[model samples]
Target: MSYLDPETSKKLVPIGRFMGEHFTGGNWTELGFLTGCDSIVQNHPRLLRSLSFGDDDYPEACLAVVGSMVRNDPDNLKLIEDYIIEHFSESGPNISTIPGLGPTIRFSPTVFKVPTHPQDAKLVAVMMPFGPSFAGVYEAIKSACSQTQWFYAQRADDIWKDTTIIQDVFDLIFRSQIVVCDYTGRNPNVFYEAGIAHTLGKTVIPITQNSADVPSDVMHHRYLTYLNNGEGLNHLTLTLAQRLRTLDPTLAQFA
Candidate 1:
């Protein structure tokens, strides 16, 4: 009943070992759930019940379980990588087993986040000080994104999730491919969010009402300056649309 060949399954050991070591915390079930290994978990209900895996006395436990999975279906390897490892880090691990993988797995910082999530290629998150004056500006940007018919834009205040507001903001930025940050008035919160976006390696488009409002350190980056009037908003919409189309290559066209 094995789908993956012996050699192929053997190559996945490093991946399993890496997962066992680094992905600790109550995450085993979430990992299985995210990867759609429901049947595999159901088959060994007792053994798979733990939220934490391979971090205790039996270190090879997770590897053993993953070995069982790949033999049933090699596709699980790619699923775990996509839904887990790559989502966990910007740097994607080589699927191919490398020499000293066991040691190299430790070289990576121990950052375990359960319930992995993927980036939204079409999500454009806007970072700006939430206020009445900025409301028009936000709408203008949203309109600009609508021109692409491919990007969906939203700001932090637009949605409140079950988690803390700050956590919600982190999740939003984490999943976004493009982030638009307004530095007008040099708002501290906006500045902090901009730093987060930059660190996450999102394509940050800086827009401000005045050139002088742009921060000193980030002056190297070009900022789109605009007026918030009816005519100015229209112009901002047109120019921003062009910039977005140029920046986002996730799609050629979307109906």
Candidate 2:
């Protein structure tokens, strides 16, 4: 039960408290236990270091424990899964959930430096590729956000094998200020990328050709609905430009 060192335990104390407050229904004792669990699973330096070094033994061991627990007690397993998924799914729980936990700690696997040059830095990252269906929308975004450098995953060179595509996407999203996610065709990849942006607390602008494409959980948020035709592109450009200006007035000059 006592698997984490002192330092790691200290780091996860806030996460446990936050989970306890928001997810445990005011169960202070449960909060303490969850905090300890969070420390072991998330803040353990040895486990994190092993993960960083591509070692899987520690994680596998943890998973084995979870598997055994599930076999031993299915009801308890459901409870554990529900708690973890409610607050720690997607990119995992972070300091943001706990008000006094200090500055946010980025847990992205690939740490990258933001561009120093003002012009070289990207402002908005468009997650959709430059395909025939999305080309007009892509161009419209560029025209609307002229001052912001936009990026697409397909623009990356194939120098790295296809296995690195997700990593490359993460690198790009991490470096950008905002992310534009188009949910056209119900593309699973786009949904995954949008989730990452949200978990990182990045400003995400969701756009879709059809309302049905937007996921149910995020349906409450504002999104741009557009057609894939000339008229639709024109309207989309105008609407997005207005949104950009509203979000950041400086972008109005470029629009």
Candidate 3:
């Protein structure tokens, strides 16, 4: 049997019935059901409590149902959005929200605003000189996103034809609560941005693909190292995840 609430389960009835009729029906492992249990459960607890349908097991069951739909039907993006929004809000039994839900799955504007709750979180800025070399940038981004609201300001080329762009980049850096700088190439522009972020009192995370690439002056600062091969991406993810936990204990695990 499905683990979602009867109402939400109804939205998935067609698909479930179709699978039942054409495919051999199997069981949903309890452990698998909770794996993708919407991240919002931890983010918003009020909604979970409000939506609980009397039975104490309803919340977990609802979460498992939503997780199953999301994992099984990637193309049915609307359903996933509905699940996220529904869980994000503590609104009553009736509320008009997210017209086409899926399209609204993007980050909420409030997440960009200054954090009110200590855990509402700080903004993290990233300074990566050579974008192409940092495949782990994606994972690092995911790690940051999980821990705090962040914006990425990457310098594509050190030589900018228009100096005005430098100011724009500086604005992004200064607005950030923390700055992560990748010094894999000893790129001067990156060091410049790092110095600016440091002056502005933004926490700076200095990392390099190799320790040898670290600039002499910044060498005293601890740096994360990785091999340029595939393993580099994994190392970056794990290291960044650990560092992010230090930044925010609430995000000790993957968000």
**Counted clashes in each candidate structure:** 0, 0, 0
Instruction: Give a tens-digit lDDT track for model 2, residues 67-149.
Output: 33333333333245345544555543321211133444546344433323221124566787446767778888777675332
Report the C-alpha lDDT of model 3 over 1-255, residue by residue, as the tens digit: 223334344545443333222221112222123344344333444334434434344444444444455445432324443333354434311111112222222322321232232211245666776556565565555554553433323332433433465654565564455677878777888888887766545678887777887888878888787666666666676777567656552332233
Model 2, position 138, has a per-residue lDDT of: 85
TM-score of each: 0.56, 0.49, 0.44
- Distance (Å) between predicted and true CA of 183, model 3? 0.7
Predicted structure with the largest TM-score when compared to the true one: 1
In terms of TM-score, how similar is model 1 to the real structure? Answer: 0.56
Candidate 1 local lDDT, 1-255, one digit each (tens) = 355554555656766667655654335667667656655655654344443342253335566667777655555655665655444654463222112233222223233122145667678899988888888999999999999888889887788763666666776787787889989898888898888777656778899988888889999998798898988888888988888887544332220
Identify the runs in model 2 with alpha carbons over 4 angstroms from their true place. Answer: 1-122, 147-163, 249-255
Say which prediction, candidate 1 or candidate 3, comes out ahead on lDDT.
1
- The pairs that clash in candidate 2 are none
State model 2's lDDT. 0.55
Which candidate would rank higher by lDDT, 2 or 3?
2
Q: Which model scores highest in lDDT?
A: 1
